[model samples]
Target: MTSTSTSPSAKFLTAQRSELLSRRESYLADMARSTATALELTEDGANQDMADEDGFGEGDTLNVERDRLLVVASEAKERVAEIDAALARVDAGTYGACEACGKPIPEARLEVVPEATLCVNCKTGASLRRK
Candidate 1:
């Protein structure tokens, strides 16, 4: 394999790293906003009021909406962590290498999931093993 700095794949990986960093920032911001909103609602006793009014349809709706936002925030937080790991891999010169088999992960797969640590075949095999 060529030195990472001289490889064509290095350019693509560099771009991916930039994109991932931007996405991580967005996810962090979203998580922060969501958490703040949730905390504010909690402090204002909105959840308590909604719970007490559960007999009414409005409370149920509010509860469902709150749950959805929380879920979104949780997912964003998870993605941010994944992006962090991906960045680490990029810095370590292993961003596009499969962790399981040491093969080059396909560009298509990396485009869709830059945090992936396995090539398609290895990933499939691992999944099958799990079953």
Candidate 2:
């Protein structure tokens, strides 16, 4: 895997990668807090027997919200992983090359989708296939 990072795309990818990593860390921390709260809710209900029905409903809602947040956190983690892989490609001298066609992914495309692994043509093809 040889890189062809000759233009501004490499710099943009680097910046995007760093930003994604930071965002990922933040998301993970937030998710951890939510998880801790969820666990505490279970503990409180089990041993203490929270008698407030409204409060129990609220807790249930929070659990649902926590589940949704966990999904979002997982997605952020995946995005971070992709960005890390892209950075690794940069180190391997293969950054910005389309995985599908082995062509250079345009800087504009990279700007729009920093974690893109395929060029527009390949991506379009993939979308069409899904349809």
Candidate 3:
């Protein structure tokens, strides 16, 4: 995609891309660690063969912890995916624009969420729909 040299949005996105990439890497590392921890916890929970009911509570706690870890990993994975998509938009010269309405995303929103592809209105609508 051809990008105009004078476009402030393009420049801003280019400047922010490196930071987003760094964040994406961090998220990926976190995901790996969380997933590994979750898997280990799950295995440990499953392998507990204690016949005593006293140990059952501990096993349940382990399972709950494993689930929490898995949720963290899942959220990390989603963040990575969002970062990747944002990077793609940067490459396509469409960064800082809302994907839903084709409007320019506000600088404030971009600063808060560099991977955001929707403006506040669109995002709010989508959030409400999800609820």
Candidate closest to the true structure, highest TM-score: 3
**lDDT by residue (tens digit), candidate 2, 1-131:** 56444534555757766755676677577667756765765666554436665576666766676667667656756766787787687677677788999888887777667667898999999999999
Clash count (model 1, backbone only): 0
TM-score (C-alpha) between model 3 and the true structure: 0.85
Q: Rank the candidates by TM-score, best first.
A: 3, 1, 2
Q: Which stretches of candidate 2 lie over 4 Å from their true place?
A: 1-56
Please identify which of the two predictions, 1 or 2, would achieve the higher lDDT against the true structure. Answer: 1
Q: State the C-alpha lDDT per candidate.
A: 0.78, 0.70, 0.84
Candidate 1 residue spans exceeding 4 A from truth? 1-8, 40-56, 125-131
RMSD of each: 3.6, 4.4, 3.1
Tens digits of per-residue lDDT for model 3 on 1-131? Answer: 77544244655776679879989999999999999998898777767745455678889899889889989999999999999998898887778878889888887788789899899999999999999
Rank order by lDDT, top first? 3, 1, 2
For residue 66, what is the lDDT in candidate 2?
60
